[model samples]
Target: MSQLSETTDGHLLKAITDACDGRIIQMPGPMAVTGVYPERSPPFKTIKLKGIEEFLLASARIGNRQPIILKLTPMDAVDYEAIEIESNKITQFEALEKHLVDHLGGYFNLLLGEAGADGLDAPYIASGHSLNAAITIFRREVEPLLARIKATRLAKAEQAAALAYADNDDWGTW
Candidate 1:
Protein backbone atom coordinates (compact mmCIF):
# COMPACT_ATOMS: atom_id res chain seq x y z
CA MET A 1 0.00 0.00 0.00
CA SER A 2 1.08 3.58 -0.62
CA GLN A 3 2.14 5.83 2.24
CA LEU A 4 -0.83 8.14 1.69
CA SER A 5 -3.32 5.27 1.86
CA GLU A 6 -1.68 3.95 5.00
CA THR A 7 -1.87 7.36 6.63
CA THR A 8 -5.54 7.75 5.67
CA ASP A 9 -6.34 4.30 7.06
CA GLY A 10 -4.68 5.20 10.33
CA HIS A 11 -6.65 8.41 10.62
CA LEU A 12 -9.89 6.66 9.74
CA LEU A 13 -9.17 4.02 12.37
CA LYS A 14 -8.75 6.68 15.01
CA ALA A 15 -11.98 8.40 14.04
CA ILE A 16 -13.82 5.09 14.11
CA THR A 17 -12.55 4.28 17.59
CA ASP A 18 -13.48 7.70 18.89
CA ALA A 19 -16.99 7.40 17.46
CA CYS A 20 -17.53 3.91 18.85
CA ASP A 21 -16.66 5.25 22.29
CA GLY A 22 -19.37 7.93 21.94
CA ARG A 23 -17.06 10.96 22.03
CA ILE A 24 -18.65 13.44 19.65
CA ILE A 25 -17.59 16.93 18.59
CA GLN A 26 -19.95 19.55 17.19
CA MET A 27 -19.29 21.65 14.13
CA PRO A 28 -20.13 25.30 13.40
CA GLY A 29 -23.47 25.84 11.68
CA PRO A 30 -26.89 27.40 12.16
CA MET A 31 -26.80 28.26 15.85
CA ALA A 32 -30.19 29.95 15.64
CA VAL A 33 -33.66 28.56 16.20
CA THR A 34 -35.67 29.91 13.26
CA GLY A 35 -37.86 26.85 12.80
CA VAL A 36 -35.18 25.63 10.45
CA TYR A 37 -32.63 22.79 10.67
CA PRO A 38 -33.25 19.63 12.65
CA GLU A 39 -31.91 20.71 16.02
CA ARG A 40 -33.08 24.02 17.38
CA SER A 41 -30.48 26.66 18.24
CA PRO A 42 -27.79 24.90 16.27
CA PRO A 43 -26.94 21.22 15.75
CA PHE A 44 -25.97 18.28 17.91
CA LYS A 45 -24.32 15.31 16.27
CA THR A 46 -21.96 12.32 16.54
CA ILE A 47 -20.24 9.69 14.40
CA LYS A 48 -21.63 6.42 13.17
CA LEU A 49 -18.75 3.96 13.37
CA LYS A 50 -20.33 0.66 12.39
CA GLY A 51 -22.08 1.85 9.27
CA ILE A 52 -19.17 3.99 8.11
CA GLU A 53 -16.39 1.48 8.67
CA GLU A 54 -18.46 -1.09 6.88
CA PHE A 55 -18.95 1.30 3.94
CA LEU A 56 -15.27 2.13 3.63
CA LEU A 57 -14.35 -1.52 3.79
CA ALA A 58 -17.00 -2.63 1.34
CA SER A 59 -17.81 0.22 -1.05
CA ALA A 60 -15.06 2.80 -1.40
CA ARG A 61 -13.22 2.19 -4.64
CA ILE A 62 -9.52 2.64 -4.14
CA GLY A 63 -6.97 4.14 -6.60
CA ASN A 64 -7.28 7.75 -7.67
CA ARG A 65 -10.46 8.09 -5.68
CA GLN A 66 -11.56 11.59 -4.74
CA PRO A 67 -13.77 12.04 -1.73
CA ILE A 68 -17.43 11.43 -2.60
CA ILE A 69 -20.40 12.86 -0.79
CA LEU A 70 -21.57 11.02 2.35
CA LYS A 71 -25.26 11.65 2.77
CA LEU A 72 -26.80 9.60 5.55
CA THR A 73 -30.27 8.28 6.24
CA PRO A 74 -31.80 9.11 9.61
CA MET A 75 -31.46 6.09 11.84
CA ASP A 76 -34.46 4.10 13.00
CA ALA A 77 -34.46 4.25 16.77
CA VAL A 78 -36.99 1.51 17.44
CA ASP A 79 -36.20 -0.89 14.60
CA TYR A 80 -33.96 -2.98 16.79
CA GLU A 81 -35.13 -1.93 20.22
CA ALA A 82 -35.40 -4.61 22.85
CA ILE A 83 -36.11 -2.42 25.86
CA GLU A 84 -38.21 0.67 26.52
CA ILE A 85 -38.45 2.96 23.50
CA GLU A 86 -35.96 5.73 23.19
CA SER A 87 -38.10 8.75 22.35
CA ASN A 88 -35.14 10.81 21.31
CA LYS A 89 -32.41 8.97 19.45
CA ILE A 90 -30.51 9.29 16.17
CA THR A 91 -29.18 6.48 14.04
CA GLN A 92 -25.58 5.40 13.50
CA PHE A 93 -25.58 6.85 9.98
CA GLU A 94 -26.37 10.27 11.38
CA ALA A 95 -23.58 9.88 13.90
CA LEU A 96 -21.13 8.77 11.22
CA GLU A 97 -21.85 11.84 9.08
CA LYS A 98 -21.26 14.09 12.08
CA HIS A 99 -17.97 12.37 12.79
CA LEU A 100 -16.83 12.88 9.21
CA VAL A 101 -17.59 16.56 9.24
CA ASP A 102 -15.92 17.03 12.62
CA HIS A 103 -12.77 14.98 12.11
CA LEU A 104 -12.42 15.79 8.43
CA GLY A 105 -13.96 19.21 8.70
CA GLY A 106 -11.98 20.81 5.90
CA TYR A 107 -12.97 18.19 3.38
CA PHE A 108 -16.68 18.13 4.23
CA ASN A 109 -19.72 20.26 4.92
CA LEU A 110 -22.85 19.29 6.85
CA LEU A 111 -26.35 20.06 5.58
CA LEU A 112 -29.30 19.36 7.81
CA GLY A 113 -32.86 18.88 6.55
CA GLU A 114 -35.86 16.60 6.63
CA ALA A 115 -35.04 13.08 5.50
CA GLY A 116 -37.38 12.64 2.56
CA ALA A 117 -37.85 9.52 0.45
CA ASP A 118 -34.17 8.65 0.68
CA GLY A 119 -34.31 9.06 4.44
CA LEU A 120 -31.29 11.29 4.24
CA ASP A 121 -30.99 13.46 7.33
CA ALA A 122 -27.45 14.74 7.17
CA PRO A 123 -25.57 15.28 3.90
CA TYR A 124 -21.83 15.90 3.94
CA ILE A 125 -19.16 15.94 1.30
CA ALA A 126 -17.46 12.56 1.23
CA SER A 127 -15.31 13.79 -1.63
CA GLY A 128 -15.70 16.53 -4.21
CA HIS A 129 -18.74 16.26 -6.38
CA SER A 130 -21.29 18.65 -7.78
CA LEU A 131 -24.67 18.60 -6.13
CA ASN A 132 -26.44 16.96 -9.03
CA ALA A 133 -23.80 14.33 -9.62
CA ALA A 134 -23.55 13.58 -5.91
CA ILE A 135 -27.28 13.09 -5.64
CA THR A 136 -27.29 10.84 -8.70
CA ILE A 137 -24.50 8.60 -7.43
CA PHE A 138 -25.97 8.55 -3.95
CA ARG A 139 -29.32 7.42 -5.26
CA ARG A 140 -27.72 4.78 -7.44
CA GLU A 141 -25.03 3.51 -5.11
CA VAL A 142 -24.84 4.59 -1.46
CA GLU A 143 -28.52 4.12 -0.75
CA PRO A 144 -28.40 0.40 -1.48
CA LEU A 145 -25.26 -0.03 0.56
CA LEU A 146 -26.91 1.81 3.45
CA ALA A 147 -29.84 -0.56 3.29
CA ARG A 148 -27.46 -3.47 3.63
CA ILE A 149 -25.69 -1.81 6.51
CA LYS A 150 -28.99 -1.23 8.28
CA ALA A 151 -29.87 -4.90 7.86
CA THR A 152 -26.55 -5.95 9.33
CA ARG A 153 -26.99 -3.48 12.14
CA LEU A 154 -30.38 -4.94 12.94
CA ALA A 155 -29.01 -8.46 12.93
CA LYS A 156 -26.21 -7.52 15.23
CA ALA A 157 -28.67 -5.81 17.51
CA GLU A 158 -30.79 -8.94 17.64
CA GLN A 159 -27.76 -11.00 18.55
CA ALA A 160 -26.93 -8.54 21.29
CA ALA A 161 -30.45 -8.80 22.63
CA ALA A 162 -30.23 -12.57 22.70
CA LEU A 163 -26.94 -12.45 24.50
CA ALA A 164 -28.27 -10.00 27.06
CA TYR A 165 -31.69 -11.49 27.74
CA ALA A 166 -31.72 -15.09 26.65
CA ASP A 167 -33.08 -17.88 28.92
CA ASN A 168 -34.02 -15.42 31.64
CA ASP A 169 -37.50 -16.59 32.49
CA ASP A 170 -37.67 -15.75 36.18
CA TRP A 171 -36.69 -12.55 37.96
CA GLY A 172 -36.54 -14.00 41.43
CA THR A 173 -34.74 -11.91 44.09
CA TRP A 174 -32.18 -9.30 43.22
Candidate 2:
Protein backbone atom coordinates (compact mmCIF):
# COMPACT_ATOMS: atom_id res chain seq x y z
CA MET A 1 0.00 0.00 0.00
CA SER A 2 2.80 2.38 0.83
CA GLN A 3 4.48 1.58 -2.46
CA LEU A 4 1.26 2.09 -4.34
CA SER A 5 0.62 5.36 -2.53
CA GLU A 6 4.15 6.56 -3.15
CA THR A 7 3.91 5.63 -6.79
CA THR A 8 0.54 7.31 -7.18
CA ASP A 9 1.64 10.46 -5.42
CA GLY A 10 4.86 10.70 -7.37
CA HIS A 11 3.20 9.79 -10.66
CA LEU A 12 0.38 12.26 -10.16
CA LEU A 13 2.75 15.11 -9.37
CA LYS A 14 5.02 14.22 -12.24
CA ALA A 15 2.06 13.92 -14.56
CA ILE A 16 0.69 17.30 -13.46
CA THR A 17 3.99 19.12 -13.75
CA ASP A 18 4.70 17.53 -17.10
CA ALA A 19 1.30 18.53 -18.38
CA CYS A 20 1.88 22.10 -17.14
CA ASP A 21 4.87 22.59 -19.44
CA GLY A 22 7.02 23.99 -16.63
CA ARG A 23 10.69 23.37 -15.95
CA ILE A 24 11.60 21.05 -13.07
CA ILE A 25 14.56 22.04 -10.99
CA GLN A 26 16.38 21.65 -7.67
CA MET A 27 18.10 24.52 -5.93
CA PRO A 28 19.57 25.26 -2.51
CA GLY A 29 19.02 28.27 -0.30
CA PRO A 30 19.92 31.85 -1.40
CA MET A 31 18.25 31.12 -4.79
CA ALA A 32 21.52 29.69 -6.01
CA VAL A 33 21.18 27.17 -8.85
CA THR A 34 23.14 24.42 -7.17
CA GLY A 35 21.60 21.86 -9.51
CA VAL A 36 21.14 22.74 -13.17
CA TYR A 37 18.14 20.82 -14.43
CA PRO A 38 17.74 19.42 -17.93
CA GLU A 39 14.81 21.84 -18.15
CA ARG A 40 11.77 19.62 -18.81
CA SER A 41 13.72 16.77 -20.27
CA PRO A 42 11.79 13.50 -20.32
CA PRO A 43 12.07 10.85 -17.56
CA PHE A 44 12.23 14.02 -15.45
CA LYS A 45 14.91 14.18 -12.80
CA THR A 46 13.39 14.70 -9.37
CA ILE A 47 14.76 17.26 -6.95
CA LYS A 48 13.86 19.40 -3.93
CA LEU A 49 10.69 21.51 -3.62
CA LYS A 50 12.27 24.96 -3.27
CA GLY A 51 14.05 24.40 -6.56
CA ILE A 52 10.83 23.45 -8.35
CA GLU A 53 9.25 26.70 -7.12
CA GLU A 54 12.27 28.60 -8.40
CA PHE A 55 12.07 26.93 -11.78
CA LEU A 56 8.36 27.65 -11.96
CA LEU A 57 8.93 31.36 -11.28
CA ALA A 58 11.70 31.46 -13.85
CA SER A 59 9.64 29.63 -16.48
CA ALA A 60 6.58 31.75 -15.89
CA ARG A 61 8.58 34.92 -16.39
CA ILE A 62 9.92 33.78 -19.78
CA GLY A 63 6.34 33.19 -21.02
CA ASN A 64 7.27 29.55 -20.49
CA ARG A 65 8.58 29.50 -24.11
CA GLN A 66 7.95 25.73 -23.72
CA PRO A 67 5.44 23.82 -21.65
CA ILE A 68 6.05 23.85 -17.86
CA ILE A 69 6.17 20.67 -15.82
CA LEU A 70 7.15 20.33 -12.15
CA LYS A 71 6.44 17.66 -9.54
CA LEU A 72 7.15 17.46 -5.80
CA THR A 73 7.03 14.52 -3.40
CA PRO A 74 6.55 15.39 0.25
CA MET A 75 9.49 14.11 2.32
CA ASP A 76 10.32 13.99 5.99
CA ALA A 77 11.10 17.00 8.18
CA VAL A 78 10.17 20.57 7.22
CA ASP A 79 12.09 20.16 3.98
CA TYR A 80 11.05 18.12 0.95
CA GLU A 81 11.38 18.67 -2.77
CA ALA A 82 9.79 18.05 -6.18
CA ILE A 83 10.97 15.91 -9.01
CA GLU A 84 11.03 18.66 -11.63
CA ILE A 85 10.93 19.00 -15.42
CA GLU A 86 9.84 21.25 -18.36
CA SER A 87 7.41 20.42 -21.15
CA ASN A 88 4.02 20.98 -22.79
CA LYS A 89 1.30 19.88 -20.38
CA ILE A 90 -2.44 19.61 -19.99
CA THR A 91 -4.92 19.36 -17.09
CA GLN A 92 -6.38 15.88 -16.72
CA PHE A 93 -6.43 14.89 -13.03
CA GLU A 94 -8.83 17.69 -12.09
CA ALA A 95 -11.29 16.39 -14.64
CA LEU A 96 -10.64 12.73 -13.77
CA GLU A 97 -11.11 13.29 -10.02
CA LYS A 98 -14.37 15.08 -10.67
CA HIS A 99 -15.61 12.28 -12.89
CA LEU A 100 -14.64 9.65 -10.35
CA VAL A 101 -16.55 11.60 -7.69
CA ASP A 102 -19.82 11.90 -9.62
CA HIS A 103 -19.90 8.19 -10.38
CA LEU A 104 -19.53 7.33 -6.71
CA GLY A 105 -22.41 9.63 -5.68
CA GLY A 106 -24.81 8.12 -8.17
CA TYR A 107 -24.02 4.63 -6.96
CA PHE A 108 -24.04 5.63 -3.33
CA ASN A 109 -27.64 6.75 -3.65
CA LEU A 110 -28.41 3.64 -5.68
CA LEU A 111 -26.91 1.41 -3.00
CA LEU A 112 -28.92 3.20 -0.35
CA GLY A 113 -32.03 2.70 -2.44
CA GLU A 114 -31.28 -0.98 -3.04
CA ALA A 115 -30.35 -1.67 0.58
CA GLY A 116 -33.55 0.00 1.69
CA ALA A 117 -35.68 -2.08 -0.70
CA ASP A 118 -33.79 -5.40 -0.90
CA GLY A 119 -31.50 -7.07 1.62
CA LEU A 120 -28.76 -8.28 -0.73
CA ASP A 121 -25.44 -6.48 -0.64
CA ALA A 122 -23.62 -6.23 -3.98
CA PRO A 123 -20.59 -4.13 -4.81
CA TYR A 124 -20.07 -1.64 -7.59
CA ILE A 125 -17.40 0.75 -8.75
CA ALA A 126 -18.22 4.46 -8.79
CA SER A 127 -16.42 6.78 -11.20
CA GLY A 128 -17.72 9.72 -13.14
CA HIS A 129 -17.42 13.42 -12.21
CA SER A 130 -18.33 15.91 -9.50
CA LEU A 131 -16.42 15.35 -6.26
CA ASN A 132 -19.31 16.34 -4.01
CA ALA A 133 -21.42 13.54 -5.44
CA ALA A 134 -18.69 10.99 -4.73
CA ILE A 135 -18.39 12.34 -1.23
CA THR A 136 -22.16 12.16 -0.88
CA ILE A 137 -22.08 8.52 -1.98
CA PHE A 138 -19.38 7.69 0.55
CA ARG A 139 -21.33 9.66 3.10
CA ARG A 140 -24.26 7.41 2.31
CA GLU A 141 -22.46 4.10 2.86
CA VAL A 142 -20.30 3.13 5.87
CA GLU A 143 -20.84 6.66 7.19
CA PRO A 144 -23.24 5.29 9.78
CA LEU A 145 -20.45 3.07 11.05
CA LEU A 146 -18.14 6.05 10.97
CA ALA A 147 -19.08 6.93 14.53
CA ARG A 148 -17.24 3.86 15.70
CA ILE A 149 -14.16 5.09 13.88
CA LYS A 150 -14.53 8.63 15.20
CA ALA A 151 -15.32 7.50 18.70
CA THR A 152 -11.96 5.81 18.67
CA ARG A 153 -10.38 9.10 17.67
CA LEU A 154 -12.39 11.34 20.02
CA ALA A 155 -11.90 9.09 23.04
CA LYS A 156 -9.50 11.76 24.28
CA ALA A 157 -10.40 14.81 22.18
CA GLU A 158 -11.99 16.97 24.85
CA GLN A 159 -15.60 15.70 24.96
CA ALA A 160 -17.44 13.50 22.51
CA ALA A 161 -19.74 15.51 20.33
CA ALA A 162 -23.12 14.42 18.95
CA LEU A 163 -21.66 11.48 17.01
CA ALA A 164 -18.66 12.36 14.84
CA TYR A 165 -17.86 15.85 13.60
CA ALA A 166 -17.13 15.32 9.95
CA ASP A 167 -18.79 18.57 8.79
CA ASN A 168 -21.27 16.45 6.80
CA ASP A 169 -21.71 13.88 9.56
CA ASP A 170 -25.50 13.77 9.41
CA TRP A 171 -25.87 10.01 9.26
CA GLY A 172 -28.20 9.70 12.27
CA THR A 173 -26.90 7.53 15.16
CA TRP A 174 -25.19 4.16 15.31
lDDT of 2 by residue, 13-34 (tens): 3323233333332233333212
What is the TM-score (0 to 1) of candidate 2?
0.22
> Please, what is the TM-score per model?
0.25, 0.22
Evaluated at residue 164, the lDDT of candidate 1 is: 69
RMSD of 1: 20.4
CA error at residue 128 for candidate 2, angstroms: 11
Q: Model 1, range 1-174, lDDT digits (tens) per residue?
A: 454322433333333233333232232232211111253344333322322111121111111233332222223332211111010121223454444334433221211121122335544545444333333443344333444544666788899977666556563333
Poorly placed runs, candidate 1 (over 4 Å): 1-126, 166-174
Best by lDDT: 2
Overall lDDT per candidate, in order of appearance = 0.32, 0.36
